[model samples]
Target: MELHDRRQAPWHDDSFEGEMVAVMTVGVPGGEVLLETSRLLLRPWRVDEAVVQRELWTERDPRVPPHRRIDEDGHPTVAELEDSIRTHKVWSTGLLAVERKASRDVIGYCGLVDSGRGATGEPELAFELLRRVWRQGYATEASLAVVGWARSSGYERLWATVWDWNTASRRVLAKVGFIETDRKEVDAVHGTTLFTTRPL
Candidate 1:
């Protein structure tokens, strides 16, 4: 969800490279999800769950853009987020909520998204977890499930973008079979964006 508006020349940065769930649920907007992991459930986000998304906004690192965070004006307020959830397609090709089975608490989201860096029909893998859930293997677990799902869905390739300094996410991506490519976008304020790819 941290796409940049500024475009820059792509270059080779040899910094690093790296990088699911199941449940049967219907009537959700995310295309009849049947994805689950041993301890997680990847399902469509609910309208009432905007508060969860809001919490994620609060937990974002300061380096994250002001627009993506809760600004002084409280932009992207819960009501706006709820409206977005009500209207956003999310279909089978959008991010789904990552919910822990034992507690039924949603950690965050993992799935594919239409990224500008990718070709038509080639979606990018995206994921984010609550700070409290970090290092619990939830991100890796949910990401693996998404990869399997992408492979089964006939996608021949998947892309991912991460900040250069985010070693944690870089490790997760490497663990999941994504290799860092030469393509990169540098933002002076936010840092460099690294692109990675995996072929199914």
Candidate 2:
């Protein structure tokens, strides 16, 4: 499992969604990469999953990166999350509800954001999982699939911005193959931090 140099990474001609992705077991080759890993399924987001959507607001203290959390109110309303989903419909993003199949729970979301492309213009990757699901590899798994989608879907890179102090999100971004692509100080409506990314 030695990592390949990004400089020499092979560029596949196949466009995402045009062909069936190859999903393979670790150490196996030539399988379509749908990225349906154990305990998680990477898919699209829906507005109906709002209660879980409120995880964006509810799980903030001590965990959520500054950029990910909502306002000073410290509580994200399901109405706000639902409005977010409805707004995204006007422009498509890979925003998906991360549901735990065993419990049929809509725990939270992970996906691409149309804006915040960083200096490199890589579509930014974003996620806000319920506090209950932290440390379970769900964020990493979902982010991996998102990175895969970005690669296969004609995108040369992906980005994620985080408060440098948010160690958990920093860990998730690192686990998903995004490197520190860029940084800049912006007036923090809330907290002052920025972490951007490019292709791995």
Candidate 3:
């Protein structure tokens, strides 16, 4: 798909707020249905997209803090992305690829993961977008769609953590109706992190 200006695209809508909608296709075995938002597609990661995943890990915007960007060893090699795909397959929920509908370019990933932080089995929402797409509403838009899907799948609640200094991501979580919880944790990688949640 050719990339287009999402802001002016005609397919954008707010219907995700009311129901769980999907594109009528089978997703990864045991995963949730494929999801589509006004400007994006949320689906299982394809093996062919490993190169894109590597790019996201290696080419992040310079403004991203060291802890958030690629590790000292540099970008994840294609072999690593392939291994990650196998791991995502076993997740109770997806770590779906976020693709621009207009261009079909894989941007990043968003979905739920089992958290070990508070309650051991709580599901946590997670997302990361390509740096080039920063400041756009894609993160918020994709998250709302994921939340809708999670609710339909019978999840009662979702959790997330954002580094204190990553204010931009915090705002995206807030926009999607996530409220900060009274929990904070210290991480070796991210320092102090704030926890947030949204009830399904």
Candidate 4:
């Protein structure tokens, strides 16, 4: 999964509760639905959680574009994020908040996004986790849940694009059943974007 764009792209790019019963309610419109895994909860972002989003912006790698980062003027302020959360309409295919079930702390986001890079209705699989949660299998776990969600929702396939340099993310995608294809979009500054897909 590309770890960058939350609303406009595959890259660039939330929390939780309880004994963690994994629940998935299908047939929901606007992506306003909930899902859970043994250690993660995938759900919509609350308006008050803009701070977390802002923190994510700050944590982005320097390779990310300035606009996606905090920016010189702090363009994507928490207030701006709050307003975005108030207005953005997450589609049936959307990026959901990933929360750590045990601590109820939102670690990041993992879900499908319409990057306009695939066939109609075939959303891209995207995920980004806090630097603190990098190696505990959270991305793989959350991604598996999203893949299962997409398969159950009738999607025929799912795509994921990752920077060739992002080996960690590539590993996560491989673990979740995505296979790399020859497709590539070269970004001279960041690296080549490698495309991968998994058939449902």
Report per-prediction Cα RMSD to one decimal. Answer: 8.9, 9.1, 7.9, 7.2
For model 3, residues 1-200, the per-residue Cα lDDT tens digits are: 00111012122234665542344233335533467876888877877788878887787555556764678686467887777776656222367788898987988988776656645445788898888898888898889887866665556778998877788889999998899988887766546789998887
Candidate 3, residue 83: lDDT: 79
| Count: clashes, candidate 3 | 2
TM-score for each candidate, following the candidate numbering: 0.84, 0.67, 0.77, 0.85
Q: Give the alpha carbon lDDT tens digit for every residue of 99-150 in model 2.
A: 6667767677776665644544456788878877789877877676566655
Which of candidates 2 and 4 is the stronger one according to TM-score?
Answer: 4
- What shift in Å separates residue 16 of candidate 3 from its native position after superposition? 3.8
Steric clash pairs (candidate 4): 3-12, 4-11, 4-12, 4-13, 5-11, 5-12, 5-13, 14-106, 15-106
Q: Cα lDDT for residue 90, model 3?
A: 25
TM-score top scorer: 4
Model 3 spans with C-alpha error above 4 angstroms: 1-14, 17-32, 59-75, 90-93, 118-121, 187-189
Better of 1 and 4 by TM-score: 4
Candidate 2: RMSD to truth: 9.1
Angstrom error of the Cα, residue 109, model 2: value is: 0.9
The total number of steric clashes, by the backbone 3 Å criterion, in model 1 comes to: 14
Model 1 regions lying over 4 Å from their true place:
1-30, 91-93
> Order of candidates by TM-score, top first?
4, 1, 3, 2
Q: lDDT value for candidate 4?
A: 0.76
